[model samples]
Target chain A: MTRVYLDNNATTIVDPKVYDVMSPFFCQMYGNPNSLHSFGSETHPALRTAMNQLYKGLNASDDDDIIVTSCATESNNWVLKAVYFDKILNGDKNHIIISEVEHPAIYSTCKWLETLGVKVTYLPVNHDGIVEAHTVKDFITDKTALVSIMWANNETGAIFPIKEIAQICKEKNVLFHTDGVQAVGKIKVDVQDVEVDFLSFSAHKFHGPKGVGGLYIKNSQELSALLHGGEHMGGRRSGTLNVAGIVGMGLAMELANDAIEYENKEVRRLRDKLEDALLQIPKTFVVTSRDKRTPNTMLISIKGVEGEAMLWDLNKAGIAASTGSACASEDLEANPVLMAVGADKELAHTAIRLSLSRFTTEDEIDYTIDVFKKAVIRLREISGSYAE
Target chain B: MAKNDLIGGSIWEEYSNKVAELMNNPKHRGRFTQEEADSKGFKLIVADFGAESCGDAVRLYWLVNPNGDIIENAKYESFGCGTAIASSDMMVELCIGKSVDEAVKITNLDVEMALRDSPDIPAVPPQKMHCSVMAYDVIKKAASLYKGVDMASFEQEIIVCECARVSLSTIKEVIRLNDLKTVEDITNYTKAGAFCKSCIKPGGHEDREYYLVDILRETREEMEKDKLLQNANTVFGGGTVAFNDMTIVQKIKAIESIIDENIRPMLVMDGGNIEILDVKDSGSHTDVYIRYLGACSGCASSSTGTLFAIENVLKAKLDNALRVFPV
Candidate 1:
């Protein structure tokens, strides 16, 4: 059976072109970029080229503006911790403002910092999972060190008003960081246009190899390093550079930049069809705002049925999807993102996220709609909560 | 489907094939009606159990023979995740054809073991083990309803780990049977302290009546005592000394003399010395209070690593129940 994978928000398959560009670096062109030799010289230029590509892709001011890291989790952690520690060293700021629906990389780090006497304010989202700019403005004070929010939510796919929030931070003279992991490839993200002090994104979310990601820091901003070792990546991030992974990420971003227009048009059309067909089922409704969310994502709740049971049925039918954030699925906790939007416990528990990608075909979307409708019907029948 | 294609590859593979089969197509899943019970000439008993943490609930039904203790039929309806449905189905299957008395004897372990594809492997992940426990608790509820007795009376032992539904006897048995060394080992074997971790020790996210740490310590002490008693004639100098018979002053003098003769030289060579403060005797146990002087007073190991070393010598020389505490 052909598998219809719709969990793109979790991770995407590496593009074959990206893989082809990365292959030569694995064995043939492999060298320590830091080592001073012919082999090192050959690899060092390749690293610079990949860095330049990412720099142009993000519309960064220069190559130094991009700091490549292992994953978005690391990049997010680096930004949060670097800002917190820098303020601590200078004895200037103590407070941080972040949205409640942030990925665990930001939320969990903030929570841990709170235990260490750092004051953190979690801004709540509206019914549509959008964090209003005024809510962020109200929380900003002179003591606030940074305002970190994600550009797009992984679970709900709701696009936050990052530009407006950045403007508020600029007016307040406070640093702003956005986890642009979901938005960078799917949407046209220009760092200069948004004017965010820092931004983070991973490669795997946009058809690149896993384990390679980048963080964008605006020029003239100074932040401490998370990992300190031999001088590498311009002393901003220190470790051995993943040359092949970096090449894959650079090529992936180039391809994503080329296909963004096509993805927005075709993917959105297919996603809307899937959403409309699924809503035809009784007691089903889209959870996220239709206008403010990513074009390739839809979060829907089928009442009286558990998401895990439904996903299991979908899996049996060769359709892959997710209940909420893949990271929090093991604990089986109700999605906090849905709850932040004022969804009741049952609604939160019943939410299923289906995210598409550039590769998602029209046939795949129709099959998913058919299989998902049947799964919901069968699950509701067995759930003992549905009336005949 | 290929095993790797599942939700989480290796982690989901921990679930037995039977559990997956039963989750997809559960047997005895619907409600057992009163009409069916009347047709079979059996009395029906219904019991409900719910987990407050996850909001998962299970309702069990038993049709018992009116003339005897045999269960004519068993069925269940679970209002939770796939694991709960699978567990309830297995629970009902295990109850059928068994006498009511025998049905009560089937434990959560039996329900879990029946779902295991192999004897050594666990049927489900540690977090999902509670579902089987929910199945086990409902059987007791049904049996109590049928027998006209309180559900609490059916519990033969106290439960130490509520998340894993591990009884004190089972914990002790696992500890003794495997010669388990630590609380982590208990979790590895029985999944006792795996989830929520309130059962591992005090000051966790939740509160519990008994803790796995306390159980392991007490069980280890009991096992130690048994070992000491088993070799009572061979251990120590000639035979074990009854330190309980001595007065507090005598116990202090005995400990100080041993320290002076054997332990003091070793400490002095390391630029440290030990001094006895007091000795107190509690029933079945003795507490020796001591103070460290010189380098040992400020040393990090003096409180823990060295204290254990001191306690070991005291246990070997004194009584098995003697506990040494730094003053």
Candidate 2:
């Protein structure tokens, strides 16, 4: 069967150009970038190019710090735990605020922090899966250490008002952190423009290698280090660096930024076509409309069919999709994103997220339309939920 | 190569082939209309059951030969995950050609076994096991509709832990067979309170009338009491003595175990607890003397409801003459 890949929000396929650039770093120029020997000094020019590529990709100022880590999870954990060390322990500010629809890295971290005398306030989202700035304003106080929210939701793809919330955090003299795992390559992200203190991103979410990620810190802020060792990344994050992964991720960011127009034009067009054809099915509703969400994501729910069963049907047809974040798929709980958006429990189980990429073709979208419709129709008839 | 290799291979590997096959091509997934049943000259029975844990529901259809009280055909409509669809298909397959009374004997265990690729392997993961349990529940709903009996009539056994389908008898039998000591031993042997842990102790996700802590204490007491009776009988000749004939040592042991297992946990939750000082068998009654600890001693209502609860547990478990007095 000719497979159609649609679950890009979970992870994207590594670009061939990135693979080509990384292959030489493994055997030919394999040396520790931190070593003083010439064998290591030979990799300096490439490492410098890679680091500069990341800085230009996210449009971070040269004076800011972009410490590379293993993945976005590591970056997110560093931001939350570092803020806990900096402001919560030494000062009277024991409070932190975050959105209810954050990824598990942010959500579960905040939950774990509550056990250590940290007061966490989970800000609820509206029916469209949006967290407003005024709501954050209502919760902020002198004792609040940080306001951490996501730039875009992985499940619903609903983009938040990061700029406005960053402004509020600045006025309240609180640090702002945005998880940019889903937003970096899928939409426009400029660290200088948004003015967020910290932004965490992963490489694999935007056609990069799996093992490398970066955290952008504005103006070299005084956040505590998560890993204390050798002076790698200016003593912020330590340990030996993954040289090949860093090189591939840097080039991948450059390529993804170069393809932003193609993502907005071609990828969005294909996603809209798939969404329109699916909406023709009975009892289907999108979680957030196209204008409010990222251009490449469509989170739809069919009335009486469960999400995992839909994935099974799509899997049989060689089509890939997701119920929500792939990390939470093993869990049998209802989709928390949909529940936070005021959806009933029944509707929460029916959420299916279909994300597109720049590599998605028109033929694949048409084939998905046919397979998804047939699967939903057959399952509905079996469930006796077909209105007709 | 699996098609789900795009991200990872966790969920695709969790489902068995039978689940994937039936989820895509469910052969017995439809409802029989009344007209179709009338044309076949068979009685039509429709039954619906919904799982409150997940939003899954299943409606069972049985075409019964009323003369013989046999089901000629069976079909189902399952609204759940892939596991539920396959489990329902397997459930309906087992129902065909069985008599109404015999079909009611079908259990969730039987449904899950029928859906398995092999006898030794499970059809679904532990989380999705509730779907097959739902499949079994819908069968009982259909049987009740066929015989015009209440659905609760088939549920005679007490369910101690609903998550793993471990009944009260099953738990007691496992404990006795293994001579289990702690609640952890009972969990490993019977898998009763592992899933949600609500069935393990006093307060958890939901309120339960039966708990593993109390059951373990009760069964251990019975075992010890049986041993003590055997020893006493051996010292004399072969004879039997009922509850009232039990010695004061045996009586005190029972009262203390009951107090710690059933009563103390509740009191400890309120930052208060009770300590049993002694058990005195008076001429007219047996009295259990206890001292209140922490805030329970200063509270006025502890003498009334608190005393009644302790006495109620002791009397129900040991002897009717037992009374609790907080000194």
Cα lDDT tens digits for candidate 2, A1-388: 8899999998999999999988988899898878999878888887888999999999999899998999999999999998898889877789999998889899999999999999999999898889988999999988999999999999889999999999999988999999999998989899988899999999999999998898999999898999999988888889887888888999999999999999999999999999999999878889876898998998998888877778878988999998862212324456777777777666767889999999999999999999999999877887886443
- iRMSD per prediction, in order: 4.9, 5.0
TM-score of chain A of each: 0.96, 0.97
Against the reference, the lDDT scores of all candidates come to 0.83, 0.85
Worst 10 residues of 2 chain A by lDDT: A324-333
Q: What's the TM-score of candidate 1 when only chain A is evaluated?
A: 0.96
lDDT for residue B110 in candidate 1, whole number 0-100:
89
lDDT of 1 by residue, B181-274 (tens): 8998999998788855667887653456888888898999999887655554333345545677554655676787678777888889999998
Q: How many clashes show up in model 2? A: 0
Off by over 4 Å in 2: A325-331, B1-9, B51-53, B161-164, B172-184, B193-327
- What TM-score would candidate 1 get against the native? 0.78
Q: What does candidate 1's lDDT look like per residue over A1-388, in tens digits?
A: 9799899999999999999989998889888888888777788776777877898898888633788899999999999888888885466899999998899999999999898788999999988889999999999998999999999999889999999999999999999999999997898899989999999999999999999998898984798999999798778899998999998999899899888898888888899999989988887778677789888898887777777677788889998898862211334555677777776565656778899998999999888888888887666655565543
lDDT of 2 by residue, B1-327 (tens): 256547645655766788878887898998899999999999999999884235577889999998898999989887777877888998899999999889888888788777778888877665566567778888889989988999889987988876687999999998888899999998898888765566788655445789999999999999998877785664344343454776787667666767778988999998998888888878979888889999899877798888888789888877888888889
